[model samples]
Target: MSERVLVPRNRGFLFLDSHPAGCRQLVADMWQACPAPAGVLEGDGPVALVIGSSAGYGLAATLAGLKRAGIRGIAMSFEKAPTVRRTATAGWYRTAATAEIADTAGRDLVFLNGDAFSDSMKEQVADLIEQRFDGRLDYLIYSVAAPRRTDPATGAAYASVLKPIGQASCTKTLVFDDEGVAEVREVETGPAEGDDVEQTVAVMGGADWERWIDHLAGRGLLADGFATAALSYIGSSLTEAIYRQGTIGAAKAHLEATARNLNERLGKMVGGRAVTSVNGAAVTQSSTAIPGIALYTGLLRGVLGDGLVPPIRQLAALWDQLTGAAPLVLDDEGRIRLDTWELTEDVQSAVAERWETATTATIADLADLDWFHNEVQRLYGFSVPGVDYSAAVATDIPWPDHAP
Candidate 1:
């Protein structure tokens, strides 16, 4: 066996190994806690396809569709396969675990692992839809978050950057160390140079999402009255400099524009709808890498506590709206605003006050770093209650069903 034990090393807050059992337990918990109401999903045969379905909002959207909406889901993800020398990525474990449980419950969901930003992958999913989904896709949830994406046509890989657009930004942020200790530090980032914004948009923008819809519709796989949602974020003024107004912001803007175009296209073609769901800030794998989100979410957790809505619940609300159980809640820009709780006047006022006074000492009181840190660990299958970390585990977990 390899040195698969979870140990403390000098890698800052970065964790490279994952626990398979822990991941399974977390998935099981979500499956049990998730609310599933019959007759809410509306249709006789509801189907969904989730790109980047292994973790975070992607995973939440997948589960929300399955449990909340009663949809048959096909999860498309690219996760590294586990080998004897090292553990697979947490997403790999999560996907495999999810498949095992779905199988046991006789629920309909399958995993396809591969690069999603490629034409071949798109065609492959189309074929899967033909075989498994009766050739009609009712929902497409595009929640991909990657550092780089290789253009399927040109083979040019564009990496997304988190820097601001016009000027540099210096803000206070929180970072966790190897000992799981949290500290506040002043981090400076921004002012995209060169073709940074263009590259970011190229990688993170709506072009790929549009291409997917185009391909699916062209292949006659989109169901009548189909719907698609691309997950996005429009943070508060606290982190807007490095987020909403940053290079990533340009990418998100392009994503929203593409949604409008796709909405028009879908309406004309199939009576379908496309929306960019402006989701709230939460402790996600991608959000942790952003400049100011850590501090923002920390204060958010402290101020809101139980008032804060989890991404999964928000996604369930998305299902409710899409299924006609509720009306669509939109902002003036025509995007769904699930972030009203995050940007509330009272909550933001408290967070703003905390941000002003937050420091190495006061951060513990003003911000909930412990909560943030624990949530992050839960993503990687660590810090989960009742998991025996000392016991040896198998790394060669299979897909438990169909493979891509």
Candidate 2:
């Protein structure tokens, strides 16, 4: 470990650094709050592979599985390792801390830090699965969110954009600082141009999810009663044009379509199942990057207050549904609907009323802007309750050596 002190450096809403102890504390807190599964899932416990399992809902889901049920997991993500000069990404610290936590409970969490979208990485995961945790996987969770993806077959790169499709969109969004709500402005974005939608879909859509399942199936690595689910979102009409009907929306549509196809494919392979879960909005790194979501989520938090189901709760509910503790609550498209509480008629009406009249002057009253800042800060391991911000921290935490 390098002897260095780290504080969160903000470039607008994105954080430049992460704290290792705070990250561990955050995971420990989530573990403490997450309840155990009501019943056994797929046997005593499942060996799960969580692609993109470092942050947000993915991390929440991973923790839920580990604490609620005895899930020995393999996670994959591409996070920058720390050097003597620069600190590691938040995900890197999060993954390391979680592995350490897992060890105390006698649970194993093997992490493969590499490009999850590539065939070579998939091969590495397969070999590890075969050699380490029994040669079969019971559960797979796809939760990758990134701005760019390179096609493994053609070596072509595609970058995803968060812009509207078909028509331009303009809306009110928040721009804030550590103090409180700084400004509220109308952010306008142009429609997707040539190849924008396609590229975004290629980067964010279900092609990779299909690829993972196919690779695992081809290798005869999928266990009986196998189940897979990919996380998704269908936003409210408050920011529909720029979100649910935008370039990112097209990618989500393709993802849902792939889930349908994979549902059938998994059934044929091992009498297994696949589903896409439409989760509620939380202040994730991906959600905060969208044009007008900052304002929306703040208002949402204010209106919903304690009523809003946190990501960990929602994920734990998902685990229960998948494991027969409860029935799956699906929408018309056969996708799980965990966003129901977030999109309730009462909640949306309150938020929409606030959206119409919220200005820089009244944003504090109309929205939980400070809460948004706090959540965003917590995502990068700052703003945590028990962390020592000014003290010297061991910045360069090494990834655990868990080779199979």
Q: Give the true-structure RMSD of model 2.
A: 1.7
lDDT of 2 at 208: 93
Q: What's the residue-level lDDT of 338 in candidate 2? A: 89
**In model 2, which range of ten residues has the least summed lDDT?**
36-45
Alpha carbon lDDT of each predicted model: 0.84, 0.87
Judged by TM-score, which candidate is best? 2
What TM-score does structure 2 among the candidates reach?
0.96
User: How large is the C-alpha RMSD of every model relative to the true structure?
Assistant: 2.0, 1.7
* Model 1 worst lDDT window (10 residues): 1-10
